[model samples]
Target chain A: MDTIIQTVTSITWQQIVMMVIGGVLMYLGIKKNYEPTLLVPMGLGAILVNFPMTGVLTQTINGQKTEGVLDVLFNAGITTELFPLLIFIGIGAMIDFGPLLSNPFMLLFGAAAQFGIFFVVIVALLFGFNINEAASIGIIGAADGPTSIFVSNQLAPNLLGPIAIAAYSYMALVPIIQPMAIKLVTTKKERRIRMEYQAESVSKQTRILFPIIITIIAGLVAPVSLPLVGFLMFGNLLRECGVLDRLSNTAQNELVNIVSILLGLTISVKLTAGSFLKVQTLMIIAFGLVAFIMDSIGGVLFAKFLNLFRKTKINPMIGAAGISAFPMSSRVIQQMAQAEDKQNFVLMYAVGANVSGQIGSVIAGGLLLGFFS
Target chain B: MSAALTQGFELMLFGMGGVFAVLFLIYLVCIALNRIFSGKPKE
Candidate 1:
């Protein structure tokens, strides 16, 4: 009777708190439909990992110490960089760079958006985070989960959960965060400025050559980025080659789904209450917000600067697309534009810049890894 | 503290330089490709 009472009391407040947090994640997934694929599994994994006295973490078989199944999957997939790379392949296949190809200047917006990463890296270091940890945290600004994972794995694997959670959360909240940032930085006149959309149809030759050329150039320039850049370009090649429709379809759907499940649950293994409920995690979240805001500012400021020399003025609102939330950021920009003037503009240019942001963010991650390495 | 600041400054400079180099290369490649493939306005 005493042993049973002891067992009942052994389950602590912290574990109970973690369970509640897990339940919240589940509610968010099932009810709100916010990133359901990831949040659902992650919520389950969090509950499994936080259960106390389970001996799941310490269990051994045949006199040999072995990690629990989920922990093993986590370390093998995430720590080894398998999950992020596979996800990148799918992202590459899903992307159509036609819009960016038409508007080459969009690349500038992409590059500009990365200002948040560098700026926050410095700020984080001042806050006493080591260089490696700072790099990992700063990548949350990329508004990309895989890039954040890849960079954190290379630079600071321990911070993976916070970084990944922050990246995805901020990405989901982009619609809210970006408008305020845009409104703060750009006057209504600038938001109302309409740019002409040139309809440039790229040829098949250009489409096929792009992935190959970018792969070779980027791989040569930043050898450290080869695996990521190479695989991403390969996926794009599979897409553009027009010979592997089945493979492209698989990459976009089946392959991405499997990898996302593994990645989601594996990432949650780190959400054990002790590591996650901390001052460091809180600071990382705060700085992640800073990085995102700075990215918006950087992209918008760059666009404003360019307006000085150009006959054609760009809608500064489109600069928000530079944060690489992809179509979401572009959609937000379009809505904001429409809010000001019903027929003000279309979303194509913002979409182009958003795609450019994807490439730019990946390249920046590679460059950071190379510089630090 | 100063030493850390110096290192931070170097990293910042390197990061900025990389951004510039990358931006220039992307712009140049895009423009060059456009010029090469402009091709009689795609009738």
Candidate 2:
């Protein structure tokens, strides 16, 4: 009776607060339909682990040793970097890259959009995070959840929970965040600018060779990014190879879904009230928004800059799609363009930039690894 | 600037420069591949 009372009374306000946060995340996931698949599992995991002396995580029970399922999964998945890499395979399979291949110039926006990662690293440092922690937090700007997780896991494991939460939450808010950033930077004239989308047919051979050549280039330039670039390209190779249809389909569907569940839950292990309920967590969230906003501003400004030298002006709105939120960023840009003029169809160009952002985010992760590691 | 600040600036330069260089190379490669393999013009 006394033991039960002690256990019940030991529940601090911090744990209660964490449990409420978890509930809110679950509510957001189920009710609002914002990243339901990831948020639901992550929210549940956060709640489960916060229960005092819970066996959901590895803990010594009474006297005998015990290992929790979440801990086992975390050790086998996230720490090994297997989950994120596998998730990359699914992402790679889902991406067409055909649009990007047709309009390669969009790749510039992909590169430009990554500016926020480095910019925010400086900002994070100013906020008193060490260089490594700053880099990990700054990578939240990469806007690619797996890359953010992978980098934070490698560089600053202690901060992984907050960083991962910030990365995914901000990604879900891209529709809101990107448009505000775009409107702030661009004029009404710039917003209404139209782009001509020419449908260029890419050959089969080019499709097969793209993943291979890109892997080589990225590997050579930033050898540190090879695991990230390699796994992503490997998945793309499965997609483009034509002979691996079964594997590609599995990767795009079953493999991604399963890994996402595991990854989300495992990430929650780090969300204990001890680590999450802190001033730095709030600061990381704030910096993540800064990173995202800066990313949009950077891409739009670069596009506008390019217009200075070219006879044909590229619609600066496509630049905002260059963040690595994938189809979401692309879709947001397309919708924003349509809002200004229904006739403007920039989806293809936006997709091109979006795919390039995917690749750019991975490379940026690797570059940070190289510099900081 | 402080040492950490200096490192941060260097990282920004290298990171951005590296991304652009690699992606630009990819751009050029894609253009070349398209030209070589796109075949004869269709009527």
Instruction: Count clashing residue pairs per candidate.
Output: 0, 0
Model 1: residues with Cα > 4 Å off, grouped in runs: A1-8, A55-66, B39-43
TM for every model, in the order presented, reads 0.94, 0.97
- DockQ versus reference, model 1: 0.48
Expressed as tens digits, the lDDT of each residue in A1-373 for candidate 1 is 9767865786677777777877887787789776777778878877877875554454454477756777778678887889989988888898898888888888888888888998888889899998889888988988988899899978988888788878887887788899988899999989999877868877667777778888887877877777777778778887988999899989989999999999988888778887788889989999999999999988999899988998888888777798778889999999999999888775989998899888888888888898888
lDDT of 2 at B3: 88
Maximum-lDDT candidate: 2
Error of 1 at A249 (Å): 0.3
Which structure among the candidates has the greatest TM-score? 2
**DockQ of each candidate, alpha-carbon based:** 0.48, 0.63
Cα error of candidate 2 at position A206, Å? 0.6
lDDT of 2 by residue, A242-350 (tens): 9999999999999999999999899999988998999999999999999999999999999999999999898898887889998999999999989998898889999
User: DockQ: which candidate is best?
Assistant: 2
